[model samples]
Structures are given as C-alpha cells and as structure tokens.
Target: MDKYTKIIEQIKALEADMVDFKIVDFYGRLRHVTIPTTNITDKKLQFGFGFDGSNFGFAETGKSDFVARPVIKDFVELDPCLEDPTATFMCDVYEAAQDVKPYESDPRGILRKACNYMQSLGVADMATWGPELEFYLFNDLLVRTDPQAMSAEIISDEGYWGSQDDDYSFATRLPKKGGYHSVPPNDTQYQTRVEAVRRLTSLGYDVKYHHHEVGGPGQCEVEFNLMDSMVAADCIILGKYIIRNTAQEFGSYASFLPKPIFGEAGNGLHVHFLMKGKNGELVFHDPNGYMGLSKMALSFLAGILTHAPAITAITNPSTNSYKRLVRGYEAPCNCCYGMANRNAAVRIPAYATQPEEKRFEYRVGDATFNPYLALASILMAGLDGVKKSLDPEGKFGPLEKMDKGWEPPVSIPASLKEALEALQKDHQFLLDGGVFTKGMLEKFISDKMQDHLRIERTPHPVEFEMYELI
Candidate 1:
C-alpha cells in the first residue's frame, strides 16, 4: 500500500472516531476543525479544508477564507486529551484564492521560509533548537472584575503561605524560593508532571527531564532534547497543549504567563540552538575559538544580542513579560553573554563540552512567544549578523572578564511598548529574503499595541491600595 493507504490503516488501527486538523494561528494558539473519521479521504486530505482566517486574527472578514492542508508526515495516531478518539495532524495554511498559494502571514509558513532561506544561502543545512519549558501549576485561581471589587488570588497548597491552621504544617510547606527539586509532599505536582511527560513521550517528544523550579508556589519545568527548527516549533505548541490538558485532568491549572505572582520566581522559555552544514557537520564548534564557538557562532550570537530589543517584540510579546525581567529573578536584564551566567541574555552552557553538544542559550525569551515567529526572527537576526560578520568580542562581551562594577553597553528592553517601538524602528533584517513580510510586521505591531493600551486603560488593585487611604 502507498503512504496514504498506510495512514488510513494506522488511523483505523487507532480506532479513531474523528480526524482533527490542527493549525497554528498568528498569535501562536492551536485552533482546529474535526470531522468524522469515516468521512476522511485521500482527496480531502490532499485538497484541504476551508476555514475563516479572520476568526484566527489573520485577516479582515472580507478576505478571511483560507485552507488547512494536513501535513501527512506529521501526525499523532490518537489524541490523549480529547474525550473522543481522534487522529490529529499538524497543518499548513494556504490562501483560498484561485491559485491556492501558501499564506504569507502564517506563523508556521514564516518559519519554514526562514529555514529554506538559510539553506539557499548555503550557510547551514539546518538549525536545531531545544526550548526549556517553564510554567506554574496552580491548585486554583480566582479573579473578580466587578465595578465594586477587583481582585485576583492564587491558591496553591504547596505554597508556604497557604498553610492550614492545623499543627505540624511547617514541615510540609515549601519555603519561599525553595521548591527546586523538592520531592513528594513539598512538590505536590510530581505525579501530575510525570503523567504529563508520559503522555508527551507517547506523542513522540524527546523529553530530557522534568522537575520543580525555584518558585515555592508550584512552578515546574520540562526540558526537551534538540530537534530541527520546524519540528521544534511543533513540539513547543503540542507540549503546551498536553501540559495544560494534563493539568486539568489532575485537578489543577497550568499557566505559561511570565509573571503571575509578585516576589516569586517566574516562568521563562530559554531557547538553545546550533547550526549544521550541508554535509551534516557542526557549524558552531571550533576548538581554537572562544568557549569552543566558531567565528560564525560568535557572529550569530552577535546578531541576536544586537537585535534583541526588536526581537523581544515577538519573543516576549505580552505586557507582563517584562515583569519577569526585573533584577533578582535570575532573568537576563543585560545584552551581555557569559559562560553559565544566568544574569546574561546569552549563556554558554558549561556542561556542553563536546563539539556536537556546544550551543548557546538565549535566556531573554518567555513562554508568551508564538514559537514560530520567535524562533524565525531570532534565526533571521543571527543570519544577518553572520552575513555582516558582526564582531561581538569587544562590545557585548564575555561578561565574566569585565570589572566588578562595569555595566553592559545595552540592556534588554524594559517594557513591551519599548520593545515594540524598537521593532518599529529596526525590522529591516526580518524583511530580507521575504521570510517576514512588511504587512505581517505591521499587523503584529498594531495588534500588540492594542494589548499595551488595554492594560494601560485598566486600573490595577495596587493603584487602589496606594491611593485609597489618601
């Protein structure tokens, strides 16, 4: 049998009652349409399914028609979260016009174009990424937005402050900022994360490890092994889906928000990447270079550090993202780099000694990012740096060698508005090679500005606290 027939047989073996086509929206959310498995056919899968793109925030209503075509090679035999047995496949969005071209603004399409552009330039055959997923698991969350009263409360049994009135409570509660790798009673989400990892493994994710993070209030992390750029993006989306649903199944809620609580460790999505040549040789490792990084690697690092302010407009898009970048949270506030320095935006892992394992980590990003756009923009910026042969040595630095009181030349953007403004002024690198279109960048800015404005117009509880007595 051919591949199509084999896919049909596999679905049949899964006993799936429905087939779901999953597509990534402009904002990095997974939206889908499902059809009865019996109704699926080779032609329908090949031709595609129609959807309204305006609903996905992709276009105006009049020009909203789009097609989602299943990527046959990318699929899950059965979705573990849905009540109904379903076969799920990741899809590519295309225009519904007479020519049926790939949608230019599609997030996944943009990343795919970036990868292809890299190949065409003959710089590297492919780029690989490993994203460290960090999040919080809350036992319950309550929010009230009434005119008379506005409040938000987080309730987690594992939190030290959430102790019951009963005696001997101190022994069980995790101390503030002391939950890192704490076992059992202090780490209530252990089994839940184990099951989540089990589900992810069943779905073909190469999980490196899962553990409690430094937040005393239910913060958790799951790290994945390196994979190609496109596949890595897919994993980030699916991983979040599985994690959230798994949390729900365990009677909890999972949040990827950068800063959910004050005076606590916050979530971050640090990405590690490296490039390989057409002959499959590592393009980033050089025995004679600094920290075993080749000149190209240094230039790539320079590109990201150079464009970080603009890039955060996508990688750290949300208004609250900057809240996590504050001092004392281990988040990078400066554009400098250092070996194993958590305070630097780019950190060279001390453990990755082998040439194949050598790679750099960008610590400035958060989970608020739309994976495709974030990774693509970073790659584009780095490639631009490589093309220009930008030198990172004297400027951004190996921060460890700097004098004790020396300040870096640049800092990461302090707020969303600032980052967006930076992008508005410096997005030429993204426009090159047609990977990221001008229209897409414009829409992204317009939409994100709306987010900033909405937050600005709202009155916060803290404002009430400070002004009520006065």
Candidate 2:
C-alpha cells in the first residue's frame, strides 16, 4: 500500500475522529483545517485542500487562492485532549494550478528551495539542527492599547515576586536566576513538563528533556532530538502547537516572548547546526584543528558572523527581542565566535565528542522567528561564505586560546532599527539560493518596519510614571 493509504489505515485503526492538516505561514503561524476521519483518503492527500492565503499575510485578497499539499512523511498523532482524537500533518503551500510550487512567499517552499540549493552546490546532502525551545508560562495576562488607555500586565503564580500571594501557598518560589533545574517544589511545572514531553514524543518528536530555565516565573525549555534542517523547522512549529495546547489544558498560557518579564532572564531559542557531506563525514570536523573545527567550518562561522546583524532582523525580529540582547545576560551582543564561550554569538559547544556531535550553536535567534526562513537564511549566508571563501574580516578572537588581552568582536545590532538597517544593507547573501527573493525581502522589511513604527509611536507605561511629572 502507498504511504498515504498506510497513514489512513493507521488513523482508522487508532479510531481517530478528526484529522488536522496544517501549513506554517511566512510569519510562523499555524493555519489548519480540521476534517472528519471519513474524509481521510488518498485523493484528498494528492489533490490537497484549498485555503485563502490572504488571511496569513501572503498576498492581496484577490490573489489569495492557495492549496495545502499534505506531506505524509511529516504526519503525526495529536495529543490526547478531551475534545477529539486527531491526527496532524504538515503541508506545503502551492498555487491553485498545483503545477508550480509557490515561490519564496511560501515558507515551506522556501525551505525546500534552500535544501535543494545546498544539494545543487554539492556541499552537503543535509543540514541538521537542534533548537533549545525556551518559553514562559503564566497564570494570567492582559493588554490594552487605545486612544484613552494603554497598558500591559502579566501575572505568574510561579514568579519570585508572586510567591507571597495567597494563591501560591503550594508553590515553591525560585529566587531570581534560580530556576535552572530546580527540583519538585520549586519547579512548579513538573506535571506540565511531563505532559509536554509525552505529547511531543507521541507526535514523533524525540524530546531530549524539559526543565526549568534560568529565569524564574515558570520559564521552561523542551529540547527536541536533532533532525535535518527542514524537518527540524517543521518540528519547531509543531512543538509550539503542542506547548500551547498542553498549557491551555492545564489552565495556563505559554509564551515564547523573549523578554516576558523585566529585571530577570529572557527566553532564547539557541540553535545548534551540523553540516555533513554526502560521504557521511562532517565537513566541520577536524580533530587536530581549533576546537576540532575545519577550515570550512571557520568559513561558515565567518559567513554567519558577517551576516549576523542582518540575520537578527529575521531571527530576533520582534521589538521586545532587543530587550534580552543586553550585555550582562549572556545574550549574543557581540558578533564573534569562541570555543565554549557562552558570551559569543556563535558558541562551539564542548559537549560534542564525535564527528556528528561537533556542531556550533547560533545564540541570536529567539522563539519569535519563523524557523524555516531563519534557518534557510543562515544556511544561504554560510553557502555564500563557502562560495567566496569569505575571510572573517572584522574581529574574531583566538580560536585556540583566550586571554584578557583578546577583546571580543564588536557587538551585534543593539536595537530593532539597527538590525533592520543592517539587513537592508547586507541581505544580498540571503538571496544567494533564491530561498529569500527580493519581493519577499521587501515585504518582510515593510512588515517589520510597520511593527517597529507601531512600537515606536506607543507610549511606555514607565513613561507615564517618569516623564509625566517632567
């Protein structure tokens, strides 16, 4: 039997009542359609279901016609919720004609193009990624912005400051920066983490583990097992869905916002990547070399460091993102690489002992980014470096040694405006593989600039307390 038939039979055997086919848009939002189990057929899988892309910021209303082609290989069973038993599938967006795959505008298509382009260059058959998912769980959240009033508030039962509240008698409060791996009483989300792991594993994700992150107030992380770049990106979207749904089930909300609370640590999605050749040899590995890094690895690092500020415009796209990029927090403010340095933008982890494990982590990205596009852009930049043998010009510290005299490179862009300006100037590398087209770049810039303006025009709550008197 064909794969789709096997999937349908599996669904039938599982007695699944509903099937959800979802597409991740350019902005990384999950848009899906739910259908009864009776409709799970091979014809539906081949022809694909149609949807309007305009709602997803794709195009004008008139040109919004699109179809979602199910990727059966990416199918998984849904979490056990009280509502209905369901199966889920990731889909590719295509034009109504279905002959031509949608271009750069489609997030999935962009990822496919990136993979194919990498193959075309005869560089690597696949790219692998491991993203440390970071997020905050809160009991209550509220926000309002209008002509007469504007304010935002978030309350966490697990917050260090909220421990004294009457509702938190059972809670074990963590001190500031004390949340990392705290056991039972202090890690209030233990049950939630277990549920998240079970759900993610049920959905075919090999979860590493979930734990309380460095930030107090319910900050947590669920690390998935590594996968190829494209599949990893898809997993990221699905992982977020599982997190949100699981949180909702427990009467809580999960947010990936980088800086959900001020005066505390922030959430960051640090991605570790590996590039391997067709012979199954890691191109980045050299045992005798610096940090066991080959020349190609150094060039790849150079590409990323050179294009990091521009990459940040996409990787850390949100205005609140910059709030976490300050110096003292281990955020990657400096555009440099070092062996086992948490302070560097690109960190070569000391954990890798084998050729496959020898990978570097890019610390700039947060949970706000579209993983497919963000990863693809980084790959393209690295490919550009490979093509040009781009020497890292600015400042790269001692690869083998570090001393007080070795100053780190200049810092990454300090603000969204600066990051955007960097992107505007340095985005040619993103177009190397046609993974990110000019039209898409233009739209992204326009959308982000509007977001920047919206935040810029708004008055801060602190402003009323500080500037009103002045």
At residue 156, candidate 2 shows an lDDT of 76
Q: Compared with the true structure, what per-residue lDDT tens digits does model 2 show for residues 1-470? A: 88778888888877788888888887888878888988677889876888888888888798888888877763446645436778777788888754746645788788778889989998788888888899988876788888778876777776766533454434576777878888877787788878878877766677888889888788899987678887789778878887888888888888999998888788899988888898777888888866788778778888888788888998988999999999777788888787788888898888887776888899999989999888888888888878777665346664446566566565688888888888999888778767788888888888888888998998878888998988
RMSD, one per candidate, in order: 1.6, 2.3
Give the residue spans of candidate 1 off by over 4 A.
74-76, 163-170
Residue-level lDDT of model 1, residues 1-470, one tens digit each, is 66777787788888888998999999998998998989988777787899999989899999999999988873446787898788999899999998999999999999999999988888899999998999999987788988778887877887777533433545557878888998988788998899989988887889999999999889999999999998899989999999999999999999999999889998999999999997779899999988999999999999999998999899999999999999998999999899999999999999999999989999988888999999999999999999999988878988878778777787899989999999999999999899999999999999999999988888888998799999
**Which lDDT values do the candidates have, in the order given?**
0.90, 0.81
Model 2: pairs clashing at backbone N, Cα or C within 3 Å: none
Worst 10 residues of 1 by lDDT: 163-172
Residue 281 error, candidate 1, Å: 0.4
Cα displacement (Å) at residue 169, model 2: 8.4
Candidate 2 segments exceeding 4 Å error: 74-76, 79-82, 98-100, 163-171, 392-394, 399-410
Candidates' TM-scores? 0.97, 0.94
